[model samples]
Every structure is written in structure tokens, then in C-alpha cells.
Target: MRNHTALTTFILLGLTQDPQLQIFLFIFLFTTYILSITGNLTIITLTIVDLHLKTPMYFFLQNFSFLEISFTTACVPRFLYSISTGDRTISYNACAIQLFFTDLFGVTEFFLLAIMSYDRYVAICKPLHYMTIMNNKVCQNMILCCWTASLVVIVPPLCLGLNLEFCDTNIIDHFLCDANPILKISCSDTWLIEQMVIGSAVLTFITTLLCVALSYIYIIRTITRFPSAQQKKKAFSTCSSHVIVVSITYGSCIFIYVKPSAKEDMTINKSVSVLISSISPMLNPFIYTLRNKQVKQAFNDTVKKLVFLLKK
Candidate 1:
């Protein structure tokens, strides 16, 4: 029974033990991280620079992009650094820091998705009131409230690790510091913490998901009522990307965290975590922007500006 201070540095087992695979992983993940940053940055830039995108939807889109960037930046860079250097030791404080930001960004994202769904609902179902409902102040307040709520929600379970005495078993069998992996390494009884974390995840998912589902239910019902097929198709087209992103993000989150035990098989869990922390961020920008004519036009406009500047 000792303080966590004595066990300051814990060894991260990372995703693989093979030296050859580690190098290969470094290359793959490094590229993914770069792409994630660039893609998210493009979204933010377009949202900021394009006057046509000055709607509540794009406002929330930019915020979501920022979260994706921050989310991956928190975990992937550290994971890449550890894998590349073959030095997998992380300080207790650093590990805790990573877990905190990961949890923060995750819950915030949940709320943002719900908000995004509601924005779509207002736009489609109550078009006349959309502007009134999602004004700038209203949007800002919603984000602030969600972030604050996330902070409050995580405190009860986060204390589990904050007060832990990690005197034994310094090996974390994952690529980065996360709640489950950190709890697995602790010598203390983690049953309560595990329960709380799982509970929080499930509860949050159900509530926020319900909001999104209801929004969609109303949205779909209203779309079906549209007088013309083309009008209904246009509405669905606008929403399809959001639904895809939400389904992937929410589905992956539930699979990773809804388990009874945090100590799920390391191999599978690490792969899942990589998908969430590394691949998802990169995937989101593409999902939102690939077929988006507005974004393509924005990109072309920006390029022309750059070319014109060089000529000067």
C-alpha cells in the first residue's frame, strides 16, 4: 500500500511487441495523424472563410472538426512517439492527463452530435424557426453547457484513478493512456470505478442517442410529408452525412466502453482504440467533405487566392 508517487513511470505495452511491426505502425499512424489534422483544419478553414457556410450547421461542424483534431492530437501523437522511439514509459501524471482530455473530448463530442442532429431537425422540420432556435448565442450556450456537464459527469468516476495507488504492475497493455488501461494497471480494487465508468458511458449514450433519434424521427416524419419527391431527397441528402458520422462514432464508442469489465482482451481493445482515436478523426472530415460541393468550391476558391498571391 504505497502512493502513486513511487510508481511514477509506468511502461506502456503498446499495440505490438514485434519490433518490425512497431516501425510499420509508426509510419501508418504518422500518416493518419497528419491526414487527420489536415482534413479537420480544412473544415475549420472553410467554415470560417466561406460566407455561404455562415449557418448554425456549419458553426457546429467547425466545432466538431476542432474536437476531432484535439481528440486525435491527445492520443495519437503520444502513441506514435512511443512506438517510434521504442520507449513506452509514461509518467503517472502524463497518463492521467491523457485520460482526462480523452474523456472530456469524447463526452463533449457526444453532446455536439446531439446538438448537430437537433440543428438538422430545426432546419428541416421547422425551417421558419431554425434561425430563431439556433442563433449564435444559443449555439454558444449549448456548447458551453455540454462541456460543463461533461466535466461534472466525469468527476465521480475519474476520482477512481486520481486516488489510486499504483504500486505494482506498471505495464499498461495499450497504445495510450485510457481509463480502462489505467484502471487495469492499478493494484487497488477497481470494481467501483469500472461500474461508474460503464454506467456513465451507457447512460450518456442512451440519453444523447435518444435526443438524436427523436430528432431524426421528427425529421424523417416531416420529410415524408414534403409535397415533392425532390424536396424530400434534398433534406435526406443534407442529413445523410451526419447520420453516417454519428452511427460510426457512437457505435464504436459503445462497443469499446459498454463492456462489463474494462480489462477486455488487450489485442482487440487496442485495435478498437486505434480506430476511434486515430482513424475516426481522419474519416470524419472525408465523410463530411468528400462529396460536398460547397467544400470543393471553397477549396478551389482558396487555391485561386493562393495562386493570385504568388503572381503578385
Candidate 2:
């Protein structure tokens, strides 16, 4: 740990300065954070307890739900505290820790989404061998690989960021300890780190994106050749939720991170960041459940059982 920093604590300039706006932001964040946590938890519980959802698709969803909870919890709750207490100061170590977890969870999600797309491809394109190919051990190994690959992608850049020296400015432009904003405020020459960040981001984006694209291409081709319209509809329906989620996750992220001029507009970027950390997580469970008959049926069964237990 390179502890060579004159500033021990950094002040976060939160979303707004107006007290009225702060109240609104606080309420909004609190509501979304609660919903996000509850929703993701429900997904995890359903996947664990519901026997019908023991398949590879739901298994991947369970892990993705956990990542959603972790990714949002990493930053949203702290910002909520900052708003409620009117204190925006985060210790150096705390900020670093937050950055690490956020990056780890966020990066892992990309790989996981790619893996889910592949799962769909196997189910649709190669149904006969799907069971054997994506068995319990195989699913677990794929998830483990996602985490391991994400660590490999992020560790180098994060290590370089840890050595950054902040000499003068202690006020971060954005709400969280994001890598780009932190690097902007550092006194160190960030040319190398900046390149590394871009390289890593590109690597994660391209690799996972290619996997998703290829998977879907094969899936769509397979679906088109199905003998009946009913079969085609069923195949496409299975993939709809994953496709929507991938679009939301990738679209927002590409706008925020991939563009060269993204940093020029901090306000828009911050709002999009909030959506990524809060809104997306809150919506994902609903998206999966609403479109999914198996999950919905499982939820209804669980509800009936709980009601019966309470009545007894």
C-alpha cells in the first residue's frame, strides 16, 4: 500500500447543494437501495429454494443477483449516509476499499452476462447435449472462471491506482470513489494509468461482447430453423430477459465509459451512474420474474406455502 498522500480524507461533492434537493436525493436513494436489495435477495432465495429453478440458467441468474446486490451495496448505502448525515467525507482507505469492490463486482457482471448468453446458446443450439455440457460442476466452474478473469482484468490497474499521490485537491467531483474521477484529482502523472484503464475496459468489453454476439448469432439462427412457430417462440422467449438486461447494462456502460468525451459531462455521467448502481439492480429481478413463467410459478407456490404456515 503506497500511503504517500497528503490528504487523508476526501470530500465528496454529492449530487446537489440545495438542502431541498438533498432531501429529495436522500429519499430517492433510500427507496431505490431498499428495493434493489430486496429484489436481488428475492431472486437468490427463489433460485435456492425452488426446485424447478435448479437448472443452469437460474444458477447463473442467482450469482448475477448476488453481484447486483454487492455492486449496489458497495456505493449506494454510503452515499445515502452522506446525504442523511450531511457528511460527505470518506477516509482514504475506505474510498480505496469501495473502489476495489465496485470494480470487482461490476467487472464480474460482464463476464457473467457473457456466460449466461453462452448458456442460452447451448440450450437453444445444442439442446441434446445441453444437460451434459452444462452440468452442476460445469456451471460452477464457469462462474469461478468469470470471477478469476475479472480479477485478472482489474488487479493491475487497481494496483497502479493505489500508488497515486493526491497533493492538493481533496474534493472528488463525483459522488463515489470511481477510478476516473479519482485519477483526475490526483497529482501524479496519470498517463500510464489512464491507458491501462482504457485497455482493461476495452479488453473486458470486447471479449465479453464478442462472446455474447456469437452466442446470440448461433441462437437466432437455430431458432429461425425451428419446425414450428411455437418452438421458435419458446426459444426466443427464453432469451428475451437476458437480451434486455444485456442491452441495458452494456448500453449505459458504453455511453459512460467507452466514449472519449464521457468525462466532459459529469452531470450526465453521474445520473447514468446512479441508474447503473441503483435503478438497474432494482429492475432486474422484476424483469426476470415478469417474463419468466418458472420463477413466477415458484414465487406463487412459495407464497401459498408461507400463507398456509402462517394460518396453521
Q: Which candidate is the best by lDDT?
A: 2
Question: Roughly what TM-score does model 1 have, to 2 decimal places?
Answer: 0.96
lDDT of 2: 0.90
Residue 273 miss distance in model 1 (angstroms): 0.5
Best by TM-score: 2
In model 2, the clashing pairs are none
- Candidate models: Cα lDDT each: 0.88, 0.90
Q: Tens digits of per-residue lDDT for model 2 on 1-312?
A: 244555679899978899999898888888988998998899899999999999999999999999999999998999988988889999989998998999999999999999999999999999999999999999999999999999999999899987888777888888898887887777888888888888888889999999999999999999989999999999999999999999999999887777552235578888899999999999999999999999999999999999999999
TM-score (all chains, Cα) for each model: 0.96, 0.97
Candidate 1 residue-wise lDDT, 1-312, digit = tens: 137367777788888789888888889899999999999999999899988888999999999999999999999999888877778899878887888899999899999999999999999999999899899999999889889878987878887567777765888888888888878877788899899998899988998999999999999999999999999988998999999999999988898899989666767778888999989999999998875777778878988998999999
Q: Kindly report which residue stretches of model 2 are placed more than 4 angstroms away from their true locations once superposed.
A: 1-5, 261-263
